[model samples]
Target: MNKQKYWLPVLGIFVALIGCITINTPIKAADTIHENYVQKIKAKKELVMGTSPDFPPYEFVKNIHGKSTVVGLDVEVGQEIASDLGVKLVVERMDFDSLLVALETGKVDMVISGMNNTPQRAKSVSFSKNYYQSGQDLLIRQADIHRYHNYRSLSNRTIGAQTGSIQYSLVKQQAKKAKLKGMDKDNDLILALQTHKIDALAVDTATAKAFIQNTNGLIRIPSGFKTSSAGSAVAFPKGANSLVQVANQSITKIRKNDLINKVYLPKVSKYMTNHKSKKDRQKANSMWAYKDFFLAGIGYTLMISALSVCLGLLLGIFLSLMRLSKNSWAKKIAGAYIEFVRGTPLMVQLLFIYFGLGIVVNIPALLSGIIAVSLNSAAYVAEVIRSGINSINVGQKEAARSLGMSRQLTMRYVIFPQAIQNIWPALGNEFISLIKESSIVSVIGVKDLIYQSRLVQADTYRGVMPLVITMILYFIITFSLSRSMKYFERKMGHSND
Candidate 1:
C-alpha cells in the first residue's frame, strides 16, 4: 500500500474513534421552570422582600415580642403577597438605595419599601402596578412654616431628603433654586432638619404627617409644594415578567379589596395617633432606655473591625510578598488587585459582594461584610507593610545575609519584627479607621452601631439624641484606641532605646 494512503486511513480511523467516545458529564437541565422567580419562591418556601425600615408606617423596625423585627404597612403588604403566593415572607432591611440592587442581584425577589417609580429607576428595574399613591409635602420647623410655606419661598434654602428617594428628586426639580441635601435614612433627615443642616425637608404626605405627629417643633406645611403625584410599587429585576405579573395581580387584589384603606391606613392612623408624649421624649433621650441597643451595636462594630483587621493583616502580608516577588505575573496580579480595591468605593464593593457575588454563593450578611471590608482593608494594609519593609535599611538585610541567615529566616525574624514596630502606628490607625467606616456595612443590614442607633431613633421618634449618643460612643471608642496606640508606640520606642 502507498504510504500516504495508509496514513490517511489511519488518521480518519483515529478521528472516528475520538468522535465515538462519549464523555458522560452531567450538564444541568435548563430548568426554566425552577428558575422562574415565582417558582423559586415556591421551591424555597419563602419570598425575600427588601426594604429600608427607617420609614415609618411604610417600613420600620419596632420592638416585637421582645425582639427587634421590621414592621409597618409595607411589611404587612409583603405578608399579603407572600400569602397569596403561598410562601413565607422574609424581610431584608437595607438602605433605600440598596433595594433595587438587591432585586437586580436576586438578593431579594421584590422591593416593597414604599419605593416610587421614576424614569431613572425604571431603566434598571420593572415596577409592579401602583399599590398606593402619595403626594409630596414640605416638613419644616414650626417656626419656619410661614417662611417656607410655598415653593417660591424655598429659594436658596437647604432642603433635605432621603438619598435616592422620590423626595430627593422632588426637591431638586421642583425646588430647583433650593439647595438639596440627601441623607441615607429618614431618621438622619429628621435629625438634619432639627439641627438646621436643612431648613426644610421634602417628604411624602403620609411620612410627613407621621413625623409631624411625634416630633415637636416640626410641622408639615400642606400647601407648600406641588410635586407631581408619585405612586409606590414593588420593584423587580428587569425581564422578571412572571414575578411582575403575579405581583401586579396581588396589588390589584389588594386595592380592589380596599386593603390599603381598611388595613394599611388604619395601621398608619394607629401609629399616627401614637406619637411620643413629652414624658416619652424625655425618656427616649435618656441613655438608660437605649443603652443596650447602642452597646450591642458597638459590640458588633468592634467584632467586625477586629476580624477585618486580622484578616487584612494576613492577606496583606501575602499580597505584599507577592508584589515584592521577582516574578512578573505575581507583581502584576498583586498590583492590579491593590489598585482595583483601593480605587472603588467600599459601598460599591459591599453591594457587589453581598448581592452580586451572592448570586453565585450564599453568604451570611456578617461574613460577607467582614470579607468585603477585609479585602478593602487588605489593599491599604499591603501598601503599609510594603512601605514599612522598604523603609528598613538595605544594609541591615545585607548584614543578615552576610551572617549566613537564609532570606526567609531573616525576613521572618529581623525584617518583619522591625517592620511591624515601624508600622505599628499606621496599623493602629487603619484599625481605628475601620472602626469608623464599619458603619457602611449597615447598608447590607448588619446591626452595627449606626444600624442600632437608627433603630433607636425609629423606636423613639427622636433622631438627634440617638445620633448624639452614637457620636459619643464612637468618640470614646476611637479615643481609647488612639491612646492605646500611643502607649504601644512609646513602649516600642523605649524598647529600641
Candidate 2:
C-alpha cells in the first residue's frame, strides 16, 4: 500500500506536466504566427519589388516611348501579385548582389529578379514556390561552338558568370578545371566573351537565348549539369509567411493557367523583337542616342556634389572647432570619428548608411547616398580645416587676445581670415575630390554618372562606348570645376595684395 501510494503520486505529477505542455504548445505556436508583413503592405497599399534589370526576358530596362522602363516576364508576375493583393506595385532597381540586402533592410518589400532559390539563400530569407523553371546553358561564339560541347570541354578555359549568381556557383563547382571570371553585369560578361577575355559564358537558357537572338555570332550549348526544379522564385523577409502564402497562390495560378509560356514569354518575345530591329539597333548603338542618359547622370552627379559640399563644409567647420577645443572629451570624440571614417572605405560607409542605418528608418537611395557622401566628406574636410587652423602663427591669436578680444572673436576675426587664404587651394582640392568621389554613390542605385552609364550599356549592349562617354563627361565636369577653383584662387590672391 505504501509503495503504491508513493509511485502513484510521482506518476500523477509527471502526467500533469505532460498535459500542461500539450495544452500550451498550440497556443505558443499561434502566438508566434503573425502577419505583420501583409499588414504593413495593406496599410501602405504599396508592394515594393526590388530587381536587377540586366537579365533579359526576366528583367531589363527598355526605352518605351522615350522613357526607360523596367519590363519583362518577372515584372508581369510582380504586377499580378500586386493586383491580386489590391496594392500598387513599385519597382526598385539595383545590382543583383544587392537584392537580398535590400530586402533584408526593408528597403524593398520583396525581391523577384530571376532569383533562384537555393539552400544557402533560404537561411537568410523566405522563398515562394518556384514560379518558373529554367535550365543552365553556355553561350559561346559561333565559330567555337564545335570545339565546346559541354562543361567538360571548357577545361582550362576562362568561363564567365554574373557575380553572386547560381550560375557563378555552378561554374565554380562543376567547371573546377576552368578559370572563372565573375562580373556584376550581364552586358559586361557578354562583352568579355566577344572580346575573347572569356571562352564561354554560363547563364540560364532563357537569358542565353535572349542574347543569341538579339546579338549576332553567339550560340547556346547544353551545360550537361544536373539541376533541380528550384528555379526562379520570389523572396521575402524571413518569417513573412503571409506574403509567402499569397505569392504562392499567385504562382500556382500562373502555372496552372500556362501564363508563363503562353502569355508572359510571348510578351517578352515581342519586346525583344522590337529591341533587335536593324533600324532600332543602329540608333541605339550610336552614343548620340543616349545623350539624355549622360545628361541626367551629369545633373545627379552635380547635385550630389553640390549638396555634399555645402553640408560637409558647415559640419567640417564645427568638427574642426571641436577638435581644437580645450575640452578633452570633445577633442577625443571628434578625433575618433575622423580616424574611423577615414580608415574605412567610402563604399562601406555608403552601404552602412543605405542598409545599416536603414533598419531604423526607411531612407530613399538618393538621400542615403547624399547623407553618406556628406558625412564622409565632413571628416576629410575637418582634417583639412584643422591643419589650416594649426598652421596660423600663435602670435596672431595672442595679439588678438591682448586687444581685449574673446577667443571666439579672435578665431572669427583674426585667425579665420588668414586661415581661409592659406587653405584656399586645399579646400578647392577637397571640393574637386568630392565631385569625383561622389561617383561612389552610384553603387547604391543613385542615378550618378556611373550608374547611368551602366544602364546605357545594358540597354545598348555596347559596353566600351558607354564607358568612354562616361569618362569623357567626368573629365569635362572635373576640369570645369578645377578652372573655376583657379579663378577663385586668383581672386583671393589679388584680395590679399
Candidate 3:
C-alpha cells in the first residue's frame, strides 16, 4: 500500500534523532569531564597570584602616583598569563617563604615571584617553562670585597640567602665552612649585608647587580665562582596540569613575541634608573615619605589586635567557666588546653597555624592570625579570669545565696561583675600586650605594623629610621590605650565610692 511513504517518514525521524545525539555530545569530552584548574580559574574570572614583591627586576613594590603597587618582570608575565586566560589578575603579596604554602592551601591560583624550580619545591608544586635564567652571585661589603672576593675567600664567613630560594641551597652546598643564614626576602639579604648582620649574601646575579648598583657600600664578587644557575618559572598547585599547560603556552608566546625584551627590559631599565639613582635615596631613606605605608600598617595592626583580643575575651570566659565546672573532664580538658597554649611561644603557635594546620584548615592569613593569637590569648585570659573569680570574698557568694539566688544567678549577677572589675587592669594590659604581640603575625605575612616596618626597611635599606617610626607608632598606641584604661579604672573607682 503506502510502504514507500511510511519508510520515508521513519527514515526522516531516524536522521533527526541521530542529529540530536551528535549535538548533545560535547566536542571536547575530556575538558568537561576533568574540569581542570584552568577551567576553574576561568569560571571565577580571576587568577589569584601569590608573590613576594621585594625582588627587583623580577618583582618589587613602587610608589606610583602615591599608591604602592608591585611591578617587575614577573608581574608583567603574570599579566600576560591572565590575559591569555581571559581573566583578571589579582596579586597577593606575602613573605617569599610562605608563597608555596599559600599556593598549596588554595589561597592563590599561581605563584610568579621569580620562583626557581628546585627539586624540593618541585615535589610540592608543578612549575611552568623557565622564563629567565640567572646565576648565583655573592654580595659583600665594599670594604670586604678583598676579603670575600671568591668562594675560597668566603670560607668561614657568614653567608646570607633568601629563605626557600635556590640561592639558599646554593649557599649551603657550595660555600665552604660558611655559616648559612636564610633571610625571607632579597631585600632582607641585601639589608643584612648593609647592616653587617651577615658577611655576604648569595642572590641571583640580576638581583645582586641591582642591589649593588643602587645601594652604596656593597660590592659584587667578580664572576668565575662556580655556582648553580637559577631559572625562574611560574608555579601551580600540584596536579594542576591544565594550568601548567596554559602557563607554558603563555610563557612561550611571551618569549616568541619578544615581550620580555621589548616591554619588560625597558620597564626594568626605567625602574633600575629611578630606584638606583642617588637622588632617589633621600625619598627612599626618609620616614615621612613612607607615612602612608606605616599608617596602613598601624591600621592593620590595631584592627587585628582589637579583634583578636575580643575573641580571646569571649573564649577566655568560656574556658574559665569550664575550668570552674563541676565536671572533672571539663576541668581537665580546659586545664590541658591552657597549659599547652600558654607553655608554647606565640611564634610557634603562629607557625603551626600557618604551616601545619593551614594544610587542613585552609584559612586566610588574617583569619589565621586572629585564631592563633586569640587562642593563645585565651589561655592567659582564662587564668586571669579564674584568679579574679576566686579572689572574690566567699562571703559575697554566701550573701547572694542567702538572698535565694540560684547558683547560676549568683555567678552571673554577683560574681562575674566583681571579677571583671578586679581584672580590668590586667585585661587592659593584655589588650595592650596583644597589640605588640600582633607583630609576630608578620612572619606569616599579615601586613601589620611590624611587617610594614620590615617592608620599609627593605625598601629603604636603612633599618633605623623605619624601626624608629614603627616604635613611635607603637608607643603612641600603647600609651593611649594605657591612659584610657587608667581613666576607666578611675571612673569605676568613683562609681564604687
lDDT of 3: 0.81
Reference-based lDDT, residue 247, model 1: 84
- Top candidate on TM-score is 2
Q: Which parts of model 3 are misplaced by more than 4 Å? A: 1-35, 223-230, 275-281, 351-362, 494-497
Question: Per-residue alpha-carbon lDDT of model 2 for 193-213, expressed as tens digits?
Answer: 998999999999999999998
**Each candidate's root-mean-square deviation in Å?**
9.8, 11.8, 14.7
Cα lDDT, all candidates: 0.81, 0.87, 0.81
Each prediction's TM-score versus the true structure:
0.86, 0.90, 0.87
Structure candidate 2, residue pairs in collision:
none
* Clashes per candidate (backbone, < 3 Å): 0, 0, 0
Clashes of 2: 0
Off by over 4 Å in 1: 1-35, 223-230, 268-277, 359-363, 486-497
Highest-lDDT candidate = 2
- Range of the 10 consecutive residues with the lowest summed lDDT in candidate 2: 1-10
**Which scores higher on TM-score, 1 or 2?**
2
The stretch of ten residues in a row with the least summed lDDT in candidate 1 is 23-32
